[model samples]
Target: MGADERERLFQRARECSGHRRTWSEADRLWTQVIDAYRQAVSGSGRVDPNDRRQLARALWRHGMLLAARGRPAEGLATGREAVTIFEQLNDAAARDATDQGRDEALAELITAVLDLAETAFAAGEPVLRMDLLDRAVAAGLRTAGPPPSAGPRTREAMGTAYHNQATALLHRCLTGTSPDEDAREAALAASRACELRQRLMDPLRPLSVWEMANTYGLYAQCLTLIRDLDRAATVLDLGNRLVELLGPAGAQPALKLRVAATMLARERASARGGTGQRRWGWRRH
Candidate 1:
C-alpha cells in the first residue's frame, strides 16, 4: 500500500481498537492490525516502530476482552505475545524519541500480567499466579525511567498481587491440607496490602474505599481460620462498617454474607470442643 493508504489503515485500526463499547468490535480491529503486521517482518523493508506498537496494543485489548469473557488461557497467550512484541519495539526506539512509547508498552505488559495472575489464581493454578505476581511486584518497585515516579499504577499492581495471593491461599485452605502456616502468611500479606491501599487512598478519604474494606476482611478471614475469633470479629466488623459507608448498596452482599457465615462457623468450632488457639505464626503483615 502507498503511504496515504498505510497511514489511513493504521489510523482506522487504532480507532477501532480503542472503541471500548463492545468486545467483539475490539477483537475485530485487533485482528485487522495483526493481519497488517503479519505480512511485514523485522527486515522486510519499510517498517514503522509506531505500527508495531499499535499492533501490540490491539492484541492487548483483544486479549483483555477474552479474559473478561472467561477465556483466560487464550487471553494470557495473546497478552504474552503482545508483551513480547512491545518489549522489542520499545527497546528499538531511538533515544531521541520520547520514552512514552516504551512506558506505554511496559504499562500494557503490567496490566496483562496482573490479569493473568488473577485468572490463574481463580482457576486454582496458584503457581502461575505467584510467578506473575512476583515479576509484577519487582518491576513495579524497581521501575526507573525519565518518568521519575512509578505512579499509582504500581500501588494498584501490588494491591492486585496481594488480592490474588489471598485468594489462592483461601482456595488451598478448602481444597488441601492447608497447614496453617501457609494461610497465615497469605492473610498477613493481604492485610499489609490493605494498609498500603489506605495510605494511597488517603486523598480520596471520605469518598469511602470499599476495596480497602475487602482487603482488611482478608486478614479477618485468616484470623478466623486460626481460631482468633475476637480479633477476626473486630477486623470484619470494621470492614463491614466501611462497606456500609461506601454506599454501594449491593456491591458486596455476597462477601458480607461469606464473612457472616465465617463468624458463625467460628462460633460453632469453638462450641465443638475446640480449645487452644492455633497461632500458625502468621504474623499480620
Candidate 2:
C-alpha cells in the first residue's frame, strides 16, 4: 500500500485496538497496526520521525499484549525495539532542545526505560529489570530537575514508572535471597509512587481505576513483605473498595485479578495475625 493508505490503516488499527474486545480481536488489530507501520516505513524513501513514533507506540502496545498473552520472548524483542526507537528519538530531541525541551526529552527517555524494564520483568529477566529500573530512577530525577517542573501527565507517568519498578523489587523480596534489603528498598520506591499518585488525585478525585488497582495492591504487597500486616490489610481494603466501585464483573479483568490477589493476601495475613482475624474487619464486596 501507499504511505497515505498505510497511515490510514494504522490509524484505524489504533482506534480498533483501544476498544474493549476479545483477545483474538485485539491481537488481530494490533498485528494489523504493526503491519501498517512497517509498510509505511518501508514505503518512505527517508526516515520520518512521526512514522517512527507511531511505529514505536504500536510496537510497545503489541509487546504488552504479547506478554499478557504469555509470549514473553517475542514480547521482549518487540518491547526492546520500541525502547531503542524511543531512545533514538530522545537523543535527537536532546540535541535540539532548550531547558524545557531537555526536561521533556529526559522524561520521555525515562518512560522508555521503564517500559523496557516492565517488559523485562514480564520476560523473567529480573537482572535486566532491576538495572533498567535504576537507570529510569536516575533519568526520572534528572527529568524532575531542581524545582520539579514536570507537567501533570509527565508526573503521572513517572509515578506509574516508579510503581512498576517497586513492584519488581517487591517480587524480588518475595523470591530472592536478600529479603530484608529488597523489602526496605521496595517500600521506599512504593511510598514515593504512592505520594506522587496521591498528589495527582487527592481530596477532589480518586486515582484512575487502573492506578488505584495497581498502586494500592503493590504498596500493600510491599507492606506485607515488611511484615506490617495491619497496614497491608488497610491498603488491601482500599483497593477492594476500588474494585467494588468498578460496577461490574470483567469490566477490567486484569485489575479485578490484582484486586483479587490483594484480597487473598489480606486473608492470609489475617490468618497469621495475633487476633486471628483481619484487623480492618473489611470483607470483599
RMSD, every candidate, angstroms? 6.0, 5.7
lDDT of 1 by residue, 1-285 (tens): 443554566567556645556556656656765676654444568877666766676666667666766777887788778767755653564244355644554555566667667766555577887787766555545553322254454455566666656766665665567547766767676675766667666526643376677676676776677566677777776677676776665266337536644654655565575665543333231
Worst 10 residues of 1 by lDDT: 276-285
lDDT of 1: 0.62
Q: Top lDDT: which candidate number?
A: 2
Give per-residue lDDT, candidate 2, residue 164. 76
Clashes of 2: 0
- What is the model-wide C-alpha lDDT for candidate 2? 0.70
> In terms of TM-score, which candidate is strongest?
2
Per-residue alpha-carbon lDDT of model 2 for 1-285, expressed as tens digits? 566876776666666556656555767877877777776677638877777777888888778777777887888898888878777776776687665665665666677778778778778888998998887777666645422366555576678777877878877866788878988889788878877776676533434565765677777767766667678778767767766665564245346346546555666766778556433333224
lDDT score at residue 118, model 2, on the 0-100 scale: 75
